[model samples]
Target: MKALTWQGINELAVKKVPDPHLQNTHDVILRVRRSVACGSDLHLLGGYIPAMEKGDVIGHEFIGDVVETGSGVQKLHVGDRVAVSSFMACGKCWYCKQELYSLCDNANTNPAITEALWGHAAGGCFGYSHAMGGNAGAHAEYIRVPYADGTAFVVPDSVADDRAVFASDAGPTGWMGADRGGVKEGDVVAVWGAGAVGQVAARASELLGASRVIIIDRFPERLALAGQFSEGVETLDYSQVDVDDALREMSGGRGPDVCIEAVGMEAHSEGVQNAYDQVKQQLRLQTDRTTAAREAIYSCRKGGSVFLLGVFGGVVDKFPLGAMMNKGLTVRGAQMHGPRYIPMLLERMARGELRTELFGTHVMPLADAPKGYELFKEKKDGCVRPVFVP
Candidate 1:
């Protein structure tokens, strides 16, 4: 098997690797059909997330067909086309029973590492990092999926592979952001970062009855695409104006009812704070750039909710706790619970109520994954999300 492997900071390679075999009674081996690079993958590639090692396979968003299943797996079998969740959970766990799959207590093999960093360990995630779970990712020919019954959902025939692939991560993540952000009828929602997650968050806000959706970004192509695909969505070029002032004007002096920060630790910004964050990040004094997060908090309406859909690895400097306290704002965030929302998203896709095919702007073979990553990371040729057909 050939898979993308992390060699060093900003280094990736495609190399031959041993094929995966079922290791647990509930495990299955999946022949990957399609996989895509996620914005979060850049964290690992950029050395933001810790505990990653040389030669670690790195990808989480993917869809595949079951080639073999353990005897304990009853619901899924050979030849079943499935979309595996980015994270793994045991459905019988207490958190799982509460539908908080990302916080499942039984999945993370490296709990001590995460517990030291976050006060608690999250569930195992495919190909994220050693701290999340060292499971091989789907950017390969095949992968071993443990807890197959809980993690792999059979894709409906009506949903094309291109669309179904996103159900594994991006779609469910955005849906969770909107759902948890408490989007309501006629609410005004603002989302930062017009990438896949941001685009989907805006669309999900509309689906959940937000009357107005505003997407913010510096990229013209991404903003244009978001406005085009998500009906009623408006775009704001932060490069041209102060996002806070723009939001104030757009919302008629009141801030957005909900503000979502979809750009994570690597967020870029203008002015002195951006340079400060960059220098601090390079010195390893801070692990995140909080520009978008700060804007989200400051731009949100008083008493409104701010949802964080972006991935953050470590502590940030100069956070706006004062605004959150003074304004009585509600802040919520999570790693997406795929089992909680993948089914609903799939149903929407089946009914043609959701469209994600346009997100796959670049499609390449597995052999060309290195080039795909370069294009995606550099945002070359307007690459939004590059899908690798394995």
Candidate 2:
């Protein structure tokens, strides 16, 4: 089997590796049908994630077919199509009971809430940097997925792999943010960044009944795509226009009722890179990548909610905390608890309420991952969301 291994900053190579097998009773062996590069993978590649180890399989969102399942995995069987969750968690945990599966007690209740109340601490993560349970990754030909029946969701066979791919991460993350924002009919929504996550956020807002969606992105290409997914959505090229002014003008002197920040950790600082970075050879730090987050805060209406859906690991500066507090802005950040949303999102997609297919611009093979990662990092090649089909 071959998997893209992270050798160092901006260094990735396809190397022959041993295939994974069922390791735990709660585990499943998934054959990779499709996978894609996530922005978080860039963080790990750039050495921004401290605990990342060389040779760690680094990808989180992917849709796969179940090749085998452990004895305890009854919900899924071999040959079932499934979307793997970003995090593996036991279903019987205390937090899982509350729908806060990301903070599952038996998984990683670090602060100590009593073993009976919390259960066992987390053992590790799949494809995420070392700190999260370094449990291999799905970027390979096959992945050994733990907490299989508890989190692995069977994606509908009717949907194309590329369309269902984002369901593993961005699709559900977007839905979670829109749901958290409580988008209602006639709500003026603004999504900052036209990245995959941002695109999904805009589409999710539409599904949630936002009347006039406005998507802001500096990239004309992405903004154009954003306009297409959102119903008559006004596009703000923040590079050319003042975000606060444009958002205010569109909202009749008020700011957007709901603002979704999909630009994540890039919202903070330029993710300080070491001098040894070769990514710097092809990429120079564009400071505005850091501005859109604060811009999301600035363009938000008073008393409105700002939902952040980007990846983060380090400290950042220049956020308008005083303004957020003064205007009573509610801000929340999350990784999509996909297991909670996949079933419902599937139903919506089945009914055509969620138009995920429009957002997929590229469906290349897994072998072109370097090009995919480069373009995704540069927002080149009309890259909306690139899926790697193996």
Candidate 3:
């Protein structure tokens, strides 16, 4: 099988690898049809997330056809088309019972690493490195999906492959931030970053009845895309305006009711702070960047809430704990629990309430994955997400 592999830091290659088969009683073998690149993949590409190894296949947002199914897989059939969750979970676990699938106890195959890093192990994520179960990713001709009935959702006939694929990750992730960030009717919401997740978060806010949604990014293309898909959504190019002042003006003197930081550990900024963060990161002193997060916390209304949808691997410098504590704010962060939101998102997609096809700015064959990844990583040619057909 031909699969995209991580050769080293900032490196990717499409190489032939061993094919996957049924590995567990509830496992299913998916013949990958559409697999897309995620901004989170950049962390692995840049070696920010530890436990990544040479030649590991890397992709998690995808939709595929079930070519084979294990005996215990009752919900899925051999020919069912499905979108699989990026995080693996055992539906019977206590965390899973509470609908916090990402915190499932039986998912991460290698628990000692994360247990040591964060005091508890999170659920496994496909191709997210050895620390997250080391499961083979979907960026291949075929991939193994464990806990098939619990993790894979059948894509509705009304939804296209490109659109349904996002229900696997970005859609669910963005929805999680807005739904959990306390977005309410008539609330004002601001989302940091204009990537797929941010754009989706903006739209999710609107669906959740937010009166106004604001999406921030330095790139005009991404901001434009956010406005296109989201009704009544405002966009701010962070480089051109003072974010705090702009947000305050938009929210009628008060800060936004809810602020979402989706830029994650690789967040970039301008001026002295950017250089300081860069120096610290390069010196191995800081594992994650907090430019967007700090701004989100500082710009949020005193009684408002902030949710982090971005991926952060380790310790960060200069988190705004003071403002968060003083302002009576509610701050939360989580990896998306796909099972909790995917079904609703898929139904929304089927009704055209969520438009994700626009995010697939570049689509190509699996052989061009290296080029697709390069374009995606560099944000070149206005490529929002490069979708690969394997």
Task: Report residue 271 deviation for candidate 2 (angstroms).
Answer: 18
Q: Give a tens-digit lDDT track for model 2, residues 219-283.
A: 78888777666666678776577678888988989899999888765543223432222233225
Count: clashes, candidate 1? 0
lDDT digits (tens) for residues 217-289 of candidate 1: 9988998898677888999999899999889888879999999999999999988888999999999999899
Report the lDDT tens digits of candidate 3 across residue range 1-390: 999999999889999999998878999999999999999999999989999989999999999999999999999999999998899778999999999999989988899999998999989999999999898998999999999888999999999998999999999999999999989999999999999999989999999999999999998899889878888999888899999999999999999999999999989997899999988998889998899999999999998999999998789888889999999999999999999999999999999999999999999999999899999999999999999998
Candidate 1 wrong stretches, greater than 4 Å: none
- Score each candidate by Cα lDDT: 0.92, 0.74, 0.93
- How do the candidates rank by lDDT, highest first? 3, 1, 2
- Please tell me which model should have the higher lDDT, number 1 or number 3: 3
lDDT of 2 at 273: 34
Off by over 4 Å in 3: none
Worst 10 residues of 1 by lDDT: 223-232
Q: Give me candidate 3's TM-score against the actual structure.
A: 0.99
